[model samples]
Target: MAASGHTGFKRIVKAAGYSWHGLCSTFRHESAFRQELAVSAVLVPLALWLGDDAASRALMIGSVFLVLIVELLNSAVEAAIDRFGGERHQLSARAKDMGSAAVLVSILNAAVIWLLLLI
Candidate 1:
């Protein structure tokens, strides 16, 4: 019943392909995303070593993933806004700013989670 009319395993395969494309595009276009991904490369393994239990490990790793997710969303918003035009517009600026703020909040959330769990 999906809008694409492609159902069952075909839908899953198509969705996975689209997700991979988005990740590749984001990695190519966004330096911030690249930096965060680099940090995550270290953090995920550290989380595995430092975490005392399943819940703690999941929390640490999940928090790191959240940052990447938010950054992807922020990048998407900025891309859409940019596509409209280069001209300045108050609403467009606000949307971009809000997207940026969301990324910051996600990063802060991850930091707080790691700090709280570790110390």
Candidate 2:
């Protein structure tokens, strides 16, 4: 298992801080993340307004959030790949392309979900 230095409240606080740092880093460094966040900002409120029921609302909102989550993970993958391998290699290129593909798929998924919900 991983290390947990603090207990309960302190741990929660530390985690929140870490999360904030991650968000800031992603927003600052990742254009795709920023784009997804902008989409989420628009969709979340629209979901609350458009969804006929709680389940549908959750699905709508969750789909948008899922895109952001996937983008973050994809960004992390790209960052790790870049950090580990500076030289040009097929595997490194493939890894970055795969990460980009994941982000595109997530955006498509969110779009489909929204369309299905609205129509």
Candidate 3:
């Protein structure tokens, strides 16, 4: 159940606002996010043009979007971990490293998808 009592369209509107805030914040503070976004900007259009059919276009575009989604989640994880404090902790380090690894994997996934599709 939702705690805010918002339902239907109101809930969707609120959620969109929150999502926009997150995107803006990530864009402002996360250099990696910005870099990925820049790459995605180019790749998405290239996917549309290079794709042979609808399915190909969708798959190519989807792969790029997946990277952005993963990056957002990774940024969120790092932000939550950082919120705790500046003090070094094993768990915090592990969490951050894992987030970084996830981003790397997503990039590799996109590259493989593009390569297989284009080749």
Candidate 2, residue 80: the lDDT equals 88
TM-score of model 1 (CA atoms): 0.97
Error of 3 at 77 (Å): 0.5
Q: lDDT by residue for model 1 over 1-119, one digit each (tens)?
A: 99999999999999999999999999999999999999999999999999999999999999999999999999999999999999999999999999999999999999999999999
User: Which tens-of-lDDT digit does each residue in 57-108 have in candidate 3?
Assistant: 9999999999999999999999999998999999999999999999899999
Error of 3 at 87 (Å): 0.5
Q: What ranges in model 1 sit over 4 Å off?
A: none
Order of quality (lDDT)? 1, 3, 2
Clashing pairs in 2: none
Cα lDDT of all candidates, in order? 0.98, 0.88, 0.94
TM-score per prediction, in order, is 0.97, 0.89, 0.97
Pairs of residues at least 3 apart in sequence or in different chains that clash in candidate 1: none
- The true-versus-predicted C-alpha distance at residue 118 of model 1, in Å, is 1.1
Give the candidate number with the greatest lDDT. Answer: 1
Model 3 TM: 0.97
